[model samples]
Target: MLNTSEHPWKLVGPWYRPSSLGGYAVTKTALNRFSAPIIQKYADANFANNLVNEPQHSLRFNSEDFVQPFSGDPNQVITPIERAQSHTPLKLYLNTHSRFYVVVCELHCDVAGFPQVERNKVCEAGFVVRRRVPVITPELKGKVETLLQQRSQLQNDLNKVNMQVKTAQLQESQQSSDISGLLKTKSARLFSGLQSGTAEKLTEKLQDTNGQLDQLSQSGDIKIELQGWKSSDLKGVGNWLPIEETPEQITEQVIPMYPLIADPTNPNHSANGKTLWFGVIPTSLADVDSNNNPRFDDADLYEIRCFVRRHHSQFPIQKNHTDCCGDVIWSEATEGYQIAAHFDLDGTSHRPVNIKLPDLPAIRNQVNNAPAGRGASARIIAPAESSLNFATDSMDMPQGGEPLTRAGQQICFFSIFLFFIVAMFLFRLFLPILLFIFNLWFLLKLKFCIPPSFQFDAGLVGSLNFDGSFGADFNASIDAHVELMTEFTADLAVQVAIEGPDLEAKFNQPNFSITVNKGKDNEKTYVDEGVLANDLGLMIANGINASDDMRADIKNGGDSPGLSSLSLNELAGIFIAMQTEYQDVKHPELAGILPTPDSGLVYFEKVELNKEAA
Candidate 1:
């Protein structure tokens, strides 16, 4: 009976097709099956690296076109090779016929679009199965829920601590601002009305205020303490727990049959005359009932549907034309081949490059037959179950590639923050030193020079010699007028004129005065001729011309000539003589106050007297 029911083929694995070249080519449909929602944000492409050992194209995830059945007739629809380029067609023919296996199977409509005979061949060779599904246990569910709640509570506590730290920081900033304002105001008042006692009192007040500000500026550090989850906590919580199944229950159930090995007659069968079946059994079915008996009858079985595929290769073959039928000839000049060997004696060795026989099983056997000697201790033990569900998202990514934990992120942030703080602290500590050095350098650039000067009773004059050392040509002159009647009892006047590098001044006294008591009451005044002594005695004692010139002029002008040219040294000598003679005369007294002959000129210049003195 021809059954026209729906095909039962399901896409449980990657779609792979044999290429004209050696390796298999994986399609977008197969690649998308392995993709998870976590990586869906990335562009759709053949992200599966090295799946079939060939480069793949980045194509759109169009399941509509992928699941559609492609017509078997190469003439009606596109060629199989062409259709494979655009989409992975489930139905494929290798351009040859073979009498393959026969079995009752549920074939999906999309798997094949071959003729009735070809479709029947696949159906007769393949089948599907259904198994009992497992369930989760209450104990494991309760443990997971408890852990989730704990995690949530810890996160809330961490947020509260962060808020507290922020609040403390704001309070510190406000306090610092207030203290800064107070300091500025107090400092202005203290300096504006500064006094000896007031300065000390203000300084003490400022120290107290600064101390308070420091206390307020200090803040507490925030610490996050989380109780890490442990694997021991989840030791008894299994992923799934299944119920028991008995022989009575099995007899009542009509279970589907699955074929592990395909017959050699089928075109899809491997070259070695065997088809390897692979399928995943879900954890729900594999889970065991821990409380059940030792026979493990409480456990259930789950079925996972996976499609089968074969790898193909094509190579050119040519028959040897020589007398030897299966002989090959190597030519050093040709590098490739002068002749190829024929595998079949009756048939020609020539074959198309695109046509190849399957050899995957043979290669697998060769790998299994690898020698275990020479320190190679590893061995290939066949797995009891051939199907495995791999985690596709983590296939290319490395371990610890996910986002960091909250604690780890916080530690990283604090480390960077500490680095910035240290940098700012170093800048603050050295900034004043750098500025002081620069200011000192600027002050040194501002040089000043001041010249020497001379001052007098009326006005002041200065000299260009700033070092206070004068050469012999250095000149200083002065003139003075005196009233006639002040120093003498007779009509007398003294006029002085000073000139010369040594500065000799001519002192001329027209007459001197003396008063004598005649008898008891009558007094007579007349000019005394002994010497015009002590004429400059008062001037010498006052240190007006206190230089060697004044002393020389004083000593030289003391006798005989009523008036003569005299210098500061001559005047000093006359004063000494007068002091000795006038020991009985009550007038000028000598205390050695006259300038010593060795003493140099003592000149004082004031800024008001000499404009250039500044």
Candidate 2:
């Protein structure tokens, strides 16, 4: 870190960082030489410019000092009055992109031990605006409490209405289904093959059922009857008139009322002695009818009257304003012909103030008595059997006044029981077959979609004799197949096929072997070339019988050929024996170089390093 005491100048905002440094650090001497004097002169010249940017008659203005070397000044005003007279040392902590700061400061060093300083460059300097600390006043606190209470009450009312609607919907659905089923039965009999007299009677019964169903449908409707007090219930606010317009246009035109907080820190910053204006009518009463006649104008006047009835005593009297509450004055000069209130003009005011308006009243008597659950009371009328019948008719008749006989009821019960039994028997017979088909399809997907593996091979092309020595070479092939055995497990089978001139004499192994043993059981199965076909058949058959949970166990009883235990001399002896097995053997005396077991020499296979490498 540079010594901040010596280099007190710090540059902020959108400047280039040549070396990814935090910020530009410049010496105070450099700032004094370049930027300090220019900023101080400008601030002094504009000291009298207030928030309005008006020039003062007292202070002298110098137009030439404001000009910079490169960029022109965009603002004509010298300075705002908000920057009060400064007597202390000039510390120019600026806003973002406010003005340019050009300083001759060392930005980089060369190999020769010399530093570079930027000269008179037009660099834009900007400062950030941060929020002031929160200040709460008593009026704000009271308004917050009132808003919270209103929201809680409205939310409770909404929840009650939602639950009532849901219950009515469920009951309506059940009733509709019952009525429809009774009509369907009557309709079927009316159209079925029967005598004319029977068909006519069924038709009349269906008509009567439909009429009762219509009455039930009307009864189920939710007709909420609200009894709350409207704004019109209040007494003498004003002769308010609502403007005729659509709700959409009215909403766009209306501005919500807001309270202004006076700032005490600056006397000229406050809008103190002014008459605030508001539209005298509420938005609910402003609308145009289909016939183009004005609506709600009379209602809006009554609403303002009610508002004055409640708060007229609190109104302050203004000179010569007596038609209504003197606090609110009718002014046609204001937009929307609004009512106005004169505020105290003292510029030092810095507190929240309250303005009352006409709103819907909250009364428990009106709210509690409103129609709630199941909606308003309704009379459900019974269907008449005939238009001419006036009296001597039972109102609540079962099955349209044609109650079933005892024998008919018994027949209906037996038929329903028989139908249920048949349905159960059919369902039981087909369920197992469907389950078996699903299982088969699942297994087939697993078998056909298993991933396939790739294999590679590398070997010597042919046998070649070394310098004055007999050497033999071999060709080898490596192949692998991957098969998924269980849901999460897989089996990899690898086959190594090697061929040479003297293979049968050394290894004592067949041309091919199906060695199914992995590292675990240490078992190896060797199959001769002639019996390869028969062994493959047995393997496939075993695979078919294996279940999803099956695993292989091919444990060998002995160690791996016992060849690893042999010494180099013993191994040479076995090679000598292999030479005799070959008909035309070369390098017959190569075994003479082999070391004895007492010499403590071993092959690579016996070494720990070779095992780890493998």
Candidate 3:
């Protein structure tokens, strides 16, 4: 009985049939001989470096496709090759017999049209197509009818002959292996520890082993063992390994080495490009996988090889374990007698081409100034509890102090009170006059407030005096504003107190989120994602420029012209502005974003400015 489950047979994707099995074998053999050795060694090493080789993808508790959120959606489906990307089928029709009949393929079903027998054979690497068989021709239909009869007769004849050949061959190969093993046992006896009679017995066993070995080895079923057989009897033993045959290209493949999104204009279909394709998947390719699959500690079993388009044709790109790293591989099916020897991928890397945007007022700066009263009206934040940007969202930003969770806060507040008391006692005891003078000065400062036109020391803000004098201030009022005539520069400092170099430890939690919702109206009403580095730099630069102008004015006998006055609110606002402008200056857009810095990767048509840290 014909066991049809393991129906190993030739398959051509609506393309031409191979002329003979010889052609397919020969082409593939040549390719294997030429390329496997060179590539196999290095292919694995390169694959292991990918992030996909990490444990995250294979975690039993985690969904491997977690990176692709759509995987969980009921409507989402993985696309088949043809329609997954832009593709035009290299279409053809096959006639296994003189008359074309349907031949169902075991592995695929998109194609099923062929006649039985008629010496149907796949002789090339990919069955080569001669011409498209159009059904429009009328006389061709008549020929098909006659050819069907011939094919039916041939099929019956082949069925009868195939049974005897296959069964006998299977039994022979299976039996000869047993016989060869027996010979090996007997042959080993000659080398055993023994006396004269034992030696004679051993020699006898050796002779027996040799005789059986000769019989078994010379048989075609046991061709490999024929190496030890008599030279004359070894004839045609190695002939089971077929001779190479001519080949033709039946499909093309390509791979790109960067994150590629196949443009999906048709929303009705899953976003796997517009057309489906029919071609071989490189995931099954041993060249790429032999080294890649086994050695990686947590490697992905499958590598997606996309048949994408660049110059308006299909090519293959190997998606690295990360699914993002890689270069495009170009492949095409042709009638020429050649098969893919090896996939030669030129290493390619993608860096986003420099993007330039003008520096606008910072929403992030305003976001940063949530407590400092920049006003919520200046930002375009959606209704979200949190944001992905660590700097923008309050709950996510890093802060490294004991949490003031009710009880914890009470403990901390008490400790702070005790600390100040101890500090005052020590100061009063050790330096009585100094303590008295400091007390008297503070008393005077409160009793007789300095005019708005005068300046004071910079105030610090965050925790460890980062409020840039008042850098990280927890109590900055929403209604605070600085007089334009005083030296009240409120420099904002992102206080980072590290006992050592442990960022992951110190700021691991959301320490910077303390006063996020403090003053809603004081928040920014812009959608700008700008940060504060450049904007703060600008404020400092402007301060220097203004001071120079003031000195010039003072030299001309102007009233208090040399004075550089900045109120605390004005300083805070200016510092916020600088931080906003400096953060998003993508190296290429230095000037437009803020005061143009000379150092970086772009040659601006405008003059580059000398920069100093803000």
lDDT of 2 by residue, 52-88 (tens): 2311111111111121100121122222231122111
- Runs of candidate 3 with Cα error greater than 4 angstroms are 1-11, 14-113, 117-614
Pick by lDDT: 1 or 2, better one: 1
Model 1 misplacement above 4 A: 1-120, 124-134, 145-614
lDDT of 1: 0.25
- What tens digits encode model 1's per-residue C-alpha lDDT throughout 1-614? 23323333322221222211112223333322221110000011222221111112211112111222222211132233434443222211111111011111122223333111112223212112223331224544464445435544433333333333343333334433575445434433332333334434544554454444334334312111211111122333222223222111211112222333433464433212212222211111222224432211212222222222111113222222111122111101100000111222101211212323335586457557875332233343333333222334646643454442222212111223334457755654543233232322121111111001111221211211112322233333222211111222111111111010111111212332333332312233334322333334323222223233333333233332211344343443433332232122333232222222212211111111012221
lDDT for every model?
A: 0.25, 0.24, 0.24
Quantify how close model 2 is to the true structure by its C-alpha RMSD in Å: 41.5
Assess candidate 1 and give its TM-score to the true structure.
0.12
lDDT: which candidate is best?
1
Model 2 TM-score, 2 decimals: 0.12
Candidate 2 segments exceeding 4 Å error = 1-270, 278-281, 285-330, 333-399, 402-614
